[model samples]
Target: METVMGNGNGQATSGGRAANAPHSDLVLPYGDQRNDGVVQVSFTLPVAAGPLAEEAARQTMKLMGLEDPQVAEATAIGEEFTFFVGYGKLTRAVELSKLRVAAPMWEELDQAAVNQLVQDTLGRPMVVVGAATGSDAHTVGLDAILNYKGFAGNRGLEAYSAFKVVNMGSQVPNEELVAKARELGADAILVSQVVTERNVHLANLTNLVELLEAEGLRDQVVLVVGGPRITHALAIELGYDAGFGPSTRPQDVASYLAQEVSRRMLN
Candidate 1:
């Protein structure tokens, strides 16, 4: 059975979460002390709220392999629905050695530096087209990176002098985005996917890649994707050159584009 969370759009999932599960070079969640394996988990059950629901939640934690399960809170949401917040300790930890790590010796350039780099490399403004493609209606992420006002006080791509940006807004079709990129001879394409329900972002992003390939324009542009759940590794797997997740500043992406476009031009 699926559990709804956060605006009733998210479905609670379980995988044994190998990334967080214990293995070699164990790493455990810390709440009070290091390696305490303390964790807080929240979920909803179809049982009515009360003492029974809290007990059920604690047992559920035990079934999840959590030790010392404590049902912190239980509240009734519906006639037969109860939301629970539980605290527990895991008997295991995640292995650090199995993860990918990178240490790039490059710094994110400022807006001025980004413009200078583009001017120095291409001798003209770089055309970059961006959109919240497919049925993704959330434009906050896209606007934050592309609008001149920026996000969290950092300036955006539109503020960069060397960038010719065309933000196509939200719900843009994959074909329309490709056509716009081709139409503008874009040097880069930035796609934002805020909706990932049931891994829809994966299919949408993959379709964009296929479209770019079909149009024979994949090699001609730097493809970038960003969102809350996006990762560089996942983006690479989806055929994107780069991916920016949550809390990524616009300058960070601008620096990457500056460096990538510059390197491509020199090549």
Candidate 2:
């Protein structure tokens, strides 16, 4: 792969061909670049489309320490307001290589190993109840993890011989999920939320945790929450045993769930 410089402006100096490198050979441009605090942000201002609106957008970016902000796109949103999309070169980049994030560190284990461990230790299948709880009606995420066929070439929880997985589908109320878990003698409860607008998912997730704690089931079951925006740190802070984010593979959840179950049993 050949490397080309990006014009001090955001555009690539060479043709588009120079920027589209294959993932295997791609190199970081900021490998040794110093960190700067300048940043670029884009949002719609509830103002008319004209010189004044453009000036307001630039001023907002300037306040955020962004220099030479350019309004790349603007559109009329309504009769009175316009939506503006801007791009600015941010002078900031964090030292990601030096950052440390705390999370569960478990050895990867396959479905067979996970099942065998459950049978050997718990003497029964690991019961799990999963649902896309709250007002979020998306079921694809939960189905991908609980169904037997699975996603991305890895088998899901239903494929494990020692795992009894029940998927309750989407838009399930939190009270119903807790009731089902108790009825099924579940060892773990997996909650999926995809609708995040207005932090609705956050409130729903917190509500589930609060409900489980009220019912004295918070510690009895491994409570895991997953979504496109959910992070492990966010989940831990929200009183979950673990959190899986977008692009998470089936084996990642399986490995974590199996290890958590075993750990709980031992304790």
lDDT of 2 at 35: 32
RMSD of each: 8.6, 10.1
Worst 10 residues of 2 by lDDT: 9-18
Count of steric clashes across candidates, in order: 1, 0
Q: Quick one: RMSD of model 2?
A: 10.1
> Which 10 consecutive residues of model 1 have the lowest summed lDDT?
1-10
Position 111, candidate 2: lDDT: 79
Q: Give residue 96's error in model 1 in angstroms.
A: 2.5
lDDT accuracy of residue 217 in candidate 2:
91
Question: How many pairs of residues collide in model 1?
Answer: 1
Any idea what lDDT model 1 has?
0.85
How would you encode candidate 1's per-residue C-alpha lDDT over 1-267 as one tens digit per residue?
A: 112122221112122224444543677888898789899999999999988888899999999999999988888997999999999999776665554432111356777898999999998999999999999999999999999998999989999998999999999999999999999999999999999999999999999999999999999999999999997667877888877898988888898899888878888
TM-score of every model versus the real structure: 0.83, 0.71
Error of 2 at 69 (Å): 2.1
